[model samples]
Target: MRGNRGAHRGSPDSGSVTDVVVVGGGQAGLAVGYHLRRQGLDFVILDAEAGPGGAWQHMWASLRLFSPADHSSLPGRLMPIQSGHTYPDAAHVVDYLADYEKRYDLPVQHGTRAEAVHRDGDRLLVEADSGAWRAKAVISAAGTWSRPFVPALPGRGVFAGRQLHTVNYRRPADFAGQRVIVVGGGNSGAQIAADLALDGDVDVTWTTQRPPRFLADDIDGRALFDAATARRRALDAGRDDTGGVASLGDIVAVPPVREARDSGRLKASPMFERLDRDGVRWADGTRASADAVIWCTGFRPALTHLAPLGLRGRRGHITTVGTRAADEPRLHLLGYGDWTGPASATLIGVGRPARDAAREIADLLDA
Candidate 1:
């Protein structure tokens, strides 16, 4: 703590007392590790998952990245081209991440879930299931996948049929022969609904609070991330800020989604007001029967591990400057979403902010 990145392997009981301890060994964590290794900081990455891949391993089977393999890689490495596919699917991503970790040899302790972070004298203590580590700086890359969010809709409890989220969905066959209502306007909602419509025997309805927004077919994660970068540059330079990715649209028309839309199978209805025991009712005196409701509503940050720091605002977000927590300079949050950095949630975009966070930590520790 006193001498900066003068880090060494530590006492047996307390784990490694390193210059930095990074939480979550996903794309963001690995990205941070790449830059931190460049800085030659002695650091360890703690990952909750049992192996490489992070949240990608748990995603629904039909999930696919909007960009091709070359366009959707982390820093210092290109994801090997997945053969026989234009867009990489979740399984391909898992394999790429596994290989990336091996190639870089980043120090990641898999299966170690961080429980809490507490200040200890001049250093910060990260307590995890495997052991505790005291470090000069801590980077919370613990991503949002563990914290899937669902709205508190009225009469939701009484719904008799299954209620699930995108996390619970695997493939279309799981919902075959059922009336499935997919909620939310985001990509997951669209993808899941389309999955059922195109691949399964399920009768599916897509619902959004407002009309769904789909980007032009040519637009993918690569183009969207570039737009986000340009918007951030304009804002930083005090120019009339151009719009970010949201201005483009919500859904990126990956092939299956494109097919569903072009075939008129992916039609979105207005969101229902409340749920009955076996169905949902619209505010407009309309009712429909449903076998199940899947809420693809998205997630909140998995920052409960950092709760002891007392930094989150009323809305459960840590106020950030660049990637560093505004209230706690020793702490940096990455990969939660745009709040941490524009497009940082995307596979390609997280690298820039991860690089920035690593540099800031290196400088802070050197100070």
Candidate 2:
């Protein structure tokens, strides 16, 4: 029976075929899987993680969702949180994802890293570490966790201080008593700088290309998600969506960040001109000494696996109309960012696009 199933599914060894293959088992992937399951389509979710939680497993120890637990849930299930836990922590998110997968019985192959995706005649070939899957359609929901973007600043190599990206950041204790520079203007930078500067034990400097933007104190992730949805809907209806509004870049006023602000520790400095042996150098020839630098510079999409398809645009992303790849009709991308779908990277934002993408795939298959 095992051999028969393998043969039927077109295992990399046997060249079997499946109906669809969704890459990455993160929030985006899981959302898409839910839709596909509801459509009664044959599909499999390929995740590289050894266990559940997708990229949440790699988040810093103190990371917390900016949205409430109920608002941050994936499709079909609300993320369960303990009583009195308003904002779910990283562990809660991970556990919720694991339970979601189990609850839906989504065909997710854990630890199956998709190395490459290429065309195999009319079908798409997903080359994974465990094996290969041939599918009529492919949804690349692999979010950006694998590709941390560190800008190529001048003299970066000469910096003697330790440099780490947000992906490598785990805890504040790691930089205890050290003078650290937190780079970038995003929430990660704010939260991390606050974490390290807590109790005034660590000297932390925040740097940004532009002054960071903070949302109104009353606003949070739920409001931001709603705004993004409205913008997407307006644009989809051929209406102008250029009206001024708070963007996703605006930092949410989370408790820790608020506390940091009240304590006068959430200050930021203009970006330095370059990195020096000891620290960062300004254009005015002044240099600040630093023991380490943490880059909260965000990530690029993990699309190397799709390179063989030749579908990516000059922006290093595939041009997509909604979730469908413009160049490769059978290929779709979800949850990378707004380009794939509005606010698709967030847990609250992925569902609509995933559902639409699944429906399109089902329609195509039917045709």
RMSD of each: 1.9, 2.9
Candidate 2: stretches off by over 4 Å = 1-12, 243-249
Q: How well is each residue in 188-212 modelled by candidate 1, as lDDT tens digits? A: 9999989899975999989998999
Candidate 1 at 354: error in angstroms?
A: 1.3
How does candidate 1 score on lDDT?
0.89
How big is the positional error of residue 275 in model 1, measured in Å on the Cα after superposition?
Answer: 0.6
**Candidate with the greatest TM-score versus the true structure:** 1
Give the range where candidate 1 is weakest over 10 consecutive residues by summed lDDT: 1-10
The TM-score between candidate 2 and the true structure equals 0.95
Worst 10 residues of 2 by lDDT: 1-10
Residue 291, model 1: Cα distance from true site in angstroms = 1.7
lDDT of 1 at 113: 90
| Segments of candidate 1 deviating more than 4 angstroms | 1-12
